[model samples]
Target: MIGGSGHVGARAARALRRLHPDLPIAIAGRDARRAAAVAAEVGGPTTATTADVGRGDLGLERGASFSAVVTLVKDEASNAVKRAQADGVPHIAFSDFVSEIGPLVAHHVARPTRAPILLLGHTLGGAATLAALHLAQDLRSVDAIAIGCVVDADDRGGPASQADFERNEQIGQAALVLQDGRWTWARGDAATRRFADAEGVEQVGHALPLMDVVSLAAATDALSIRVDMAARDASTRGAGHATDLVVEVSGRLDDGTAARLRYDIVDADSYARLSAYGAAIATERLLGLEGGPPVGPGLYHPESLIDPARAVARLEELGARVRRTRS
Candidate 1:
């Protein structure tokens, strides 16, 4: 995997190892030493390679043997896509957390790469997406879907997250959901929701411009989809900040039946731990050990990309409790 040296990538490498010990894992980054260190920590036959994904060529042999490739580097999504295409490997891109910035970057970066590219945005990329899919399983048709998250205050994020936040403030427009099959953009008060989880009954949540919900709606059969983020308190507010996330999806089934699904993640650990676990879960799924279809090309959210049951089970094993709330 490219970018295996960074926080997300390194943690993902370790998670993949634990989830599938027999799988061969390798990490590549611009900094050889850091990559080597991460590989060592992961143990097994992890190899460290010196390559810059942004610069292309990653230094891999033309006929190199590998099942798939995951890119966790921070930057334009298009760049990641291009590099993955060059390597002719299935690509999994890290979620940028915030929805406003991810799609903007992805719009510019998705082109160029012919390889199947999956654009991941936040843990919602996997968990939220899969949950939506799972919730829709019993239904025939769904009119609209909403994904909600209530994060803890202590979660910290990586540089990419920091950059995305900075850009969001500059843009001054929150990414809106795709409602009724249209892109709706708005900048105003986020929707508020009360969440009762392991943490407590917290009035925690806001309607943030999340790309995953919008993208999921656009890509899936759902006509309308919304994603919201709510935190426990002010201390947890800000970019790269950490908090527990509560995800909920409500919509009408294809047969005009009402369906709703709720899931939650409480991170007692530091913010770094949350980010690491999210990345690791995605990596493990891509490796074909933890869950879902064989790793392949295309942009995706956790819900659309992997099996919900398997994804939730993996998250629980990582210390995150996946619970369903009463509809």
Candidate 2:
């Protein structure tokens, strides 16, 4: 684990430990003392190491090796990914914005890695996309998909998450949406969307450049796909500490009937925990800890590798509730 000293990273480490008890884990960050503290908290065969993504080898020993490298911090230099590719270790990073990932994608395309490199920058690290797929399983042909993530105003995540949030604001990146089978960048009024929350209350969301649009479009061939994010106070739902993901899909059924479906994945904990759960699930899939074949080399999205049914089950096990809201 890289950047494994922050709040979300600590949760992710615990989640991974819960799922794989005997697995050897490493908590790496620039602050060795902080990383060691988190590693001690997780217990078991975990260790703490210093990392410098500015280095090609990630500041590790010349011949160090690992089963996988999960990154929680942003690698603007792409050095972590480059090291992973060079080492042929499966890798997944959670802190990538749509605009910043293009060069990394291009680099992988130019020289594909021998180990699976997953791009999982979606809401909750691709959990929202997985839930959306599970909800659309009954559909025969998907025409459109709109994903909304409502975060509680009081639920400011860890330092890394807050930093990422600020970066998104400063970047002022236009939302990436699929429209009429063509990918488009939406801005201004076009980026604003109104949707129903889990409680059926109207909520205003602004389009965000999340990886969900690209993954959903590729997985379902949806002509219209976008993900919007909104922030609401706890009082809005008469509940403190709740984050919800609303997935709405419109398409044709197996009977050739037009239909629309919606589901809500509500987590009583903070979005940071939900996101950590997602990262843990992705790590398991990448390493084949769930009694399946490990993912092979090449680039991939979480939807391609994760089983929606299994993912939903895991989410429920992690204390997240999924409910059908509309039919």
Candidate 3:
């Protein structure tokens, strides 16, 4: 793991340890002390290493090997990606945005590797998209999809996540969405939507150009697709106020009648934990630990590599509650 010291990365390490007890783990980050602490907490053949993501070799000694490279940080320079490619190991990146993924895609196209590269930058590490796709399977046609994620106000993420938020604000990049089968850069009111949250409270969500919009569009013929997020105070809401992912899909049924479906994935714990579960699950899929074939070379979305039903089951096992709000 590249950012194994951060909150999400550390949680991913723990989740991986729980899922695969004997897997050798390397907690790598710029902060050697913090990495060591995390590794010690994870226990069982885990090592902490100082890694410089900016370096070509990831600042590791020559001949170092790993089964896969999972990064929870934003790799703006794509250094980690290139290194993974050179080593021919599966790579899973969690913090890249759709606007900044062009160079990485281009690099892979120029020289594809035998190991798979999974882009899991969706809301909560592709959790929302995977659930939405699974729910849409019961419909005959999918015309529109809207995903909303609620983050607790007090749940400020790690340094890397906060930095990414600050960087996006500084850059002022418009949110990406698909409308009427056309890609659009939404802004202001156009980028905002009002919907009921998991607690049935009215909330306004703002678009952020997450990877879910693109992935959903490719998977189904959804004429309109967008993902928005809202942050609120969880303390005031009593219990069941942790982060939640709301997915709504609308289209026609097999009988040609109008239909809509909505589901809520409520996590009683922090969003970081839910996201970590997603990363750990993806790591297992890449390594073929679930008795399935390992992912082959080429870039892919989480929807392509993961089975939504199985992912939902795994999330529930990890303390996420999935409830159908509409049908």
Q: What is the lDDT ranking, best to worst?
A: 3, 2, 1
Residue 224 Cα positional deviation in candidate 2, in Å, after optimal superposition: 1.2
> Model 2 over residues 1-327: C-alpha lDDT tens digits?
998887678888999898888989999988899999999999999999999776777888777788898988887788888777777888896888777788668767877856688998888888889988987898999999999988888777877778887898788758898989888888888899999888878889999888898888878868999999888877768473388888899999999998888878887777888889999999999999873788888888988899988998998887788887556
* Alpha carbon deviation, residue 91, candidate 3 (Å): 0.7
Q: Between 2 and 3, whose lDDT is larger?
A: 3
Q: For model 1, where is the 10-residue window of minimal lDDT?
A: 234-243
Q: Indicate the residue-level lDDT of 162 in model 3.
A: 86
The TM-score values for the models, in the order shown, are 0.76, 0.93, 0.96
Which clashing pairs does model 2 show? none
How much does each candidate deviate from the true structure in C-alpha RMSD?
4.9, 1.8, 1.3
- For model 1, how does the per-residue alpha-carbon lDDT over 43-142 read when each residue is reduced to its tens digit? 9978887766555455665556656667675545355555556666666766454543545345435553355556676544356666666666656666
TM-score of 2: 0.93
lDDT of 3 by residue, 1-327 (tens): 999888888888998898889999999998899999999999988999988887767888788888888988987778888877888889987988888788778867977865588998888887889899988998899999999988888787887888987777777858899999999999999999998888888888999878999999999999999999888877655487688889999998899998889989887777888889889889988899963788888899998889988888888887788897556
Candidates in descending TM-score order: 3, 2, 1
What TM-score does model 1 achieve against the real structure?
A: 0.76
Candidate 1 — what's its lDDT? Answer: 0.62
Q: Lowest-scoring 10 consecutive residues by lDDT in candidate 2?
A: 233-242
Candidate 3 at residue 255, lDDT?
Answer: 94
Better of 1 and 3 by TM-score: 3
